[model samples]
Target: MVKAAFKVRHITQRYLRPPGALKEKDFIGRCIRCNQCAEICPNNCIKFFGSENGADSMGTPYITPREKACILCMKCGDVCPTGAIKPIKRELEPIVQYVEMGKARVDEQLCLSYQGKSCGVCYRACPLADTAIKVGYMEQPTVLDACVGCGLCERSCIQIPQAIKVIPNHLLASQLKATHLKERRSGDNDVQIIKFK
Candidate 1:
C-alpha cells in the first residue's frame, strides 16, 4: 500500500499543465486531448503522456520545464479547443494575472550563488525579472510572489541537478485542498472553509 501510494505521488509530480490551465480534475475532464495546445507551442516544450501517467493523463499536454521552458507567447492557450487551458493575453499583466503553472523554489545548498559563487543565470532568464525574481549579493536568487512559475528560471539554472525547480500548481492545489479538509474536520464551528477546487 505504501509503495503504491508513493508511486501515485511520484506520477502526480511528474508533469505540469500549460499556462492558464484549469484545476486538475476539471482539466482532465474538459481537455479533449486534441493536441492543439502542443501544436501551437512555439517553444516546443509541450508533450503528451502515454500509459505511464495513467489513463486520466494520457494524451493530455504537459510541459517539461527543464528541457524547455515556456516563452509566455500564450499561443497554446489561444489554440485550446476546450476551456481546459483558458486563453490568456500575450501581454505581461494578463499573463501574470491569469497564468499559474507553478512556483519556482531555489535550493540554497545546490545554488552556486548561495555557495559564495556569483551566478545570476536564473534571474536573467526570468521574463518578469525583478518582479518575479530578485538577485542579492553574490547573485543569490530570491523568488517573489509575482512569479507566474513559467519555469524559465529552473531551466536556466547552472546546477547539474538544478538548484531551482517549479512546484506544479496542481500539486499545490491538492495540498491546499487537503489542508482545508483537515481544518474543516478539526471541528471549528466558526471557521469558514473556502473552496479551492
Candidate 2:
C-alpha cells in the first residue's frame, strides 16, 4: 500500500477523478481501467489518462473542469463495476455529504468581481449555490468548506486564467497528511493521526 501511495503521489497534475472516487492508491489498485464511467456520462465530461499520466494512471477516468465540468448526475458511480468509484445516490444531500472530488478556490487577483466589475458567473453556475459558495459585495465568490468541488464554477469563470479552480482532493489529502506529521514531530502530541483507509 505504501509503495502504491508513493506512485500515486508522483502523478502530480491537479486532475479530479469521477465523483465518489476512492483514495488515490486504492483507486488505482481497484480500478480495472474500464471506460464504463465515461460511456454513461450524460455531460460527456469524463476523460481517460494517457501515457503521460503514467502506466498506473493509463485509461483511468478523470475530469478536466476547465474544458468540461461534471453535472453531478451520479451516473459514473452507478456504472463503476469496481468500487473505485463508489455508488452515490442522485440526491442533493447524499451528493453533498459523500462527494469529495475537491474544493473550489477563488483567485481574487484575477477575479472581475474583486475588480468591481460585478461578475457573478461562478455564483450562478454553482449547483450548490449559496450553500457551497456565497457571493458578497460585487458578487465576489466566497468558497465555503461544504464545497464538493464539482468544478462548475471553474468552468463558468470568464477570466483569462480562470478566477476559480478546483484543487484536487488527493493533493489536499497529501497536504493534510504532511501537516499532521509535521505537527506530530514538533512535539504536538495532541495531533491526531488520521488513517487513510
Candidate 3:
C-alpha cells in the first residue's frame, strides 16, 4: 500500500492546478475539498486527488493537461466557495495578470520547428498565441512572459515526448526557495571579514 501510494505521489507531481489557485500551502489550507471547482469547470478538466494520492492531498482538485487542458473559461474560480481559487473578472487583462497556474517551457531539441519541420501547432493552439507564445526564426516556438500556463501548447504538441510543457507553479515555488537558499548561503560566505589593523 505504501509503495502504491508513493507511485501516485510521483505521478501527481506533474499535474497542474486550476487557474487563480493560491500558492500550494495556502490552497491546501483554504480548500474545503468540496469539489465545487471541478463540478463547475466547463471543460471538465478539473479532477480530485483520490485515495492513491493519500490524505494530504486527497479530494483537492487538479488538472492533468495531457488528458484535458483548461479552456480558460474562468468558471472554476467563480464557483469555489473557499478562496483557494480566487475569482477573477472574465477579461484578458485580469486573466493575464492573475491566472498564473504555471509557465510553459519549450524543449527546442524535440520541437519539429526547431528541426526545420515547419510545425507550429503548439503556437497556433495557444489561446494567448501572440502574447504567450510566438513563432521565432525557422518557426521555433518561443514562450513569452505573458503565458498563463494554460497547457494548450502541451496539448497541441505533436512531439513523441511533448516539446512544450507547463511547469506548475507549485514546482516553480520550490525551485525559487532552493535558489534563494543558495543565494543566501553565498551572501553569508561573502560577509566582509574585518580584521582590526
Candidate 4:
C-alpha cells in the first residue's frame, strides 16, 4: 500500500503541471506563486485559482483573454522581481514583434462605439496609426479593418485595469470571421463606408 501510494503521487506530479508553466520552471526552477503579477497587471489579465490540475497550478498566475488579456503593458512580467514571467529582449532577437499576447477584439456591446460615444483614446494611442487600430463610424468610433496587434488600445482603455486586451492570434481568426459575418448580416455596406476618424 505504501509503495502504491508513492507511485500515484509521482504520477500525479508528472501529469499535473501546465504546459504553459514548463518554460517558466525551466528558467526559474520554481515560482514563488506570489500574487504580485495579478496585483500589478494593467489589464487585470492574470488569473490565480485552484483546480483538479494540481497545487502548483493553483493560485499561480496565468492569463485568460476571455476573462482578460495581457496588454503588453509588461507590468506583470516586469514586476516579477523573481524573473519568472521573463521578457525576451528585442535587442537580442532584433526582428521579433516583442510581445504577441494575441489580437485585440472589440466587444461591441461593451465598447463605446455601439453607444455612439466620442472616445478616440484607442485610435489616437495606436502607434502604427491606421495600420494598427482605426476609428470607424459616422460619428461614433469603431475599429476599421487594419489592426496590427500592437496593443495600444488595450493599454489606453479606461476601464478599471482595462477592457481591451491582447489575445493569441489563433483564437482571433474565428472570432474575427464571426464579427465580419455579423456586420454583413446587418448590411453595413462595407463598400461605401469610409472611415477617417
- The top-ranked prediction according to lDDT is 2
Clashing pairs in 1: none
Task: Please provide, for model 2 over 142-194, each residue's C-alpha lDDT reduced to its tens digit, 9 standing for 90 to 100.
Answer: 99888888999999999989989898898777767787778967978666543
Score residue 161 of candidate 3 by CA lDDT.
88
The per-prediction tally of clashing pairs is: 0, 0, 0, 2
> Each prediction's Cα lDDT score?
0.82, 0.86, 0.81, 0.49
User: For model 4, how does the per-residue alpha-carbon lDDT over 97-183 read when each residue is reduced to its tens digit?
Assistant: 444334455655556655677676766766545654656663233443444344557667765555455444433444566667877
Which runs in model 4 stand beyond 4 Å of their true positions?
1-47, 52-56, 63-84, 89-96, 107-117, 124-131, 137-197
> Relative to the unseen true structure, what is the C-alpha lDDT of residue 15 in candidate 3, on a scale of 0 to 100?
78
Candidate 2 stretches with Cα past 4 Å from truth are 1-6, 9-11, 177-197
Total backbone collisions, model 4:
2
14-80 in candidate 3: lDDT tens per residue?
8788999998768878998998888888888898888645566778888888778999998988898
Give lDDT: candidate 1, residue 95: 82
Q: Ten-residue segment with the worst summed lDDT in candidate 1?
A: 2-11
Better of 1 and 2 by TM-score: 2
Q: Compute each candidate's TM-score over C-alphas.
A: 0.83, 0.86, 0.83, 0.41
- Lowest lDDT sum, 10 consecutive residues, model 2, at 2-11
